[model samples]
Target: MSSAPSSTVFLASPDADTPAAAQALATIRERVLAATARGTPLDIQGGNTKRWYGQTPAGEPLDMRMYRGIVSYDPAELVITARAGTPLAEIEATLAERGQILPFEPPHFGPGATLGGCIAAGLAGPRRPHVGAPRDFVLGAVIMNGQGQVLHFGGQVMKNVAGYDVSRVLAGALGTLGVLLELSIKVLPCPVAEATLRFALPQAQAIEQLNRWGGQPLPLMGSAWHDGVLHVRLGGAAAAVAAARATLGGEPVDAMEAHAFWQSLREQSHPFFANAPLMGDGQPLWRLSVPPTTPPLAHSDEHLIEWGGAQRWWITPRAAADVRAIAAAAGGHATLFRHGDKLAGVFTPPPAALRAIGERLQHAFDPSRIFNRQRLYR
Candidate 1:
């Protein structure tokens, strides 16, 4: 069990006083216990920005927004612990003040995004390939299970693992296992310099070039290909970024403009996203994860390649079976990312063995099935 220094700073909302928070936690616990006893379901909610994600939501609303605040932050130790409902904006602002950042670069889908929702959603931004994902940064977590028991897993430090690390499992769980109460995550120092460069090339050429650069010792942070343009972002020490820029040989974009470009891509606010409809049919968006070496898919006109070609965003009306088969042929899987018919299954079906293991874990953690039923899988 690791603890923060006593001189920790707490950034909390006005209504989230100590007594009120304690009472709120108690109420949540009681509600969970009652639901478990009655065999009812609980739909955990924070910020609700990502309510559209995952399968159709279920269970009674268990609001966690009142339990908001930063429990601890040690810049020297590169760790921050916060309550589940803490605002993502506040957390980022606090980290910015110390020239530190969450290396995973989790996206805030909307203004009211919360820390817990970000961790639960587990959606990383452009730097995900270069740095890591939300699960990689998770050091520890405190959660309330379906039985209303508070359980702690992992520790505040990265090396404290002694067995199965349950903390990381909570990432992308969609709150099916339990309700996350607090989380301690690792952070990294902000890069001293950053730049984005652009190259105009065909899809095949862009994929080849991106994969080639991936093997080299460069400050490559993010890469995306859209509209016949490949955008590469380099971040590190000033010298390294400049050296990589020279080696990459792409026209440099202005710093401010580049930042905005990346942000638009990250938040899906770019014109490409706005015009993602396939052949103007207003079809759903699909996400395909495949080997970077895989060639472009057939009839994928409205698409953007990201994560050095590992992630492909497709705006197509192709049937789920057809899209999934293509992704499988490419040696990966596909996800109906947004604006899709979720009832048809938003995620690819897991292998039988993997699904069995998930079921066992779910039963172990939530015997009564009181938490976010069928949100992750049917």
Candidate 2:
């Protein structure tokens, strides 16, 4: 629901000066054009930190790590443009210096996580439900299509577009549509205050409380339920956070401990994730996206409820179809988030009409099927 601004000054070219980035860009175009002519598929990669998140990569590796750096950043405008290979950590540090942040709260997974990988995966942190997804903050993107054509969509300023928003669509596409070269995203000022409170409750009661609180005007930033306890984070004005804390009436977590807890959850490094069975024949971790208002799901005790019960993570040995069916019945979808059968399809199968539309879009952008073939779907 965000748009680019109508008029804005063009900052320095994102690919300027860096000969390596320029070479990489030119090489990608040349390789893409040749691949298109010869029907050779290409697998785009940046940082490689998220290689295990989606289907197994195919085709020749096209490394994008060398093409990186902040293209432009206007603190006053609350926007930052960077090459696709720029490390996300660097961007966060830059924003921190300006007292701003990427509100979507993308996960780094590892030290090598890059901006392009973040966008490609489109994985948001706990703040997602309160703020928005990575796609919502995307203002513009420069990409190379299957035919090696360089195309630009959207721009630096919000409210700048009047047509189809292809920039946002590129998000979570897993490189099937094209090779991302650069991206521009909107940011926001850092919250003045933040606090986390924990309460011991059953899963059902936790879900109810979260949904109930969600309806109010409190400055809720994040929430999660695990180990027979519900943890809620509040952020905004100092007075507001304090008031909400008093009303919620839970044990206040130490400031330092709360910060570490959120970071662990964001990076999936917490013990809960570590203890989950690995991807082999054992139970694989499943991510279910359901409505927050939905009650505790069957076998829900074994799950970690996040996003105020909207995103549930469970490790189960059940078949993909069975897990997906349960999610679908609850008016949501399930994804084999990690350590699953990639060939069986990591995501829930889309409906016929949606599948057909996705096919059309894929063919339109990559007629030769030379980019990450079968990455998102078979």
Per-candidate alpha-carbon RMSD to the true structure: 4.0, 3.6
lDDT of 1 at 342: 78
The 0-to-1 C-alpha lDDT of every candidate, in the order given, reads: 0.86, 0.86
For candidate 1, the per-residue lDDT at 127 reads 95
Per-residue lDDT of 94-151 in model 1, one digit per residue for the tens? 8887788988788787888999999999999999999989999999988998888888
Report the error of model 1 at residue 43, Å.
1.2
lDDT of 2 at 320: 86
In the range 152-234, model 2's lDDT, one tens digit per residue, is: 88998998873227899888999889988899999998888999999999989999999999999999999999989899999
TM-score result, candidate 1 = 0.94
Error of 1 at 68 (Å): 1.0
List candidate 1 segments past 4 Å from native.
Answer: 1-17, 162-164, 275-282
Clash count for candidate 1 is 0
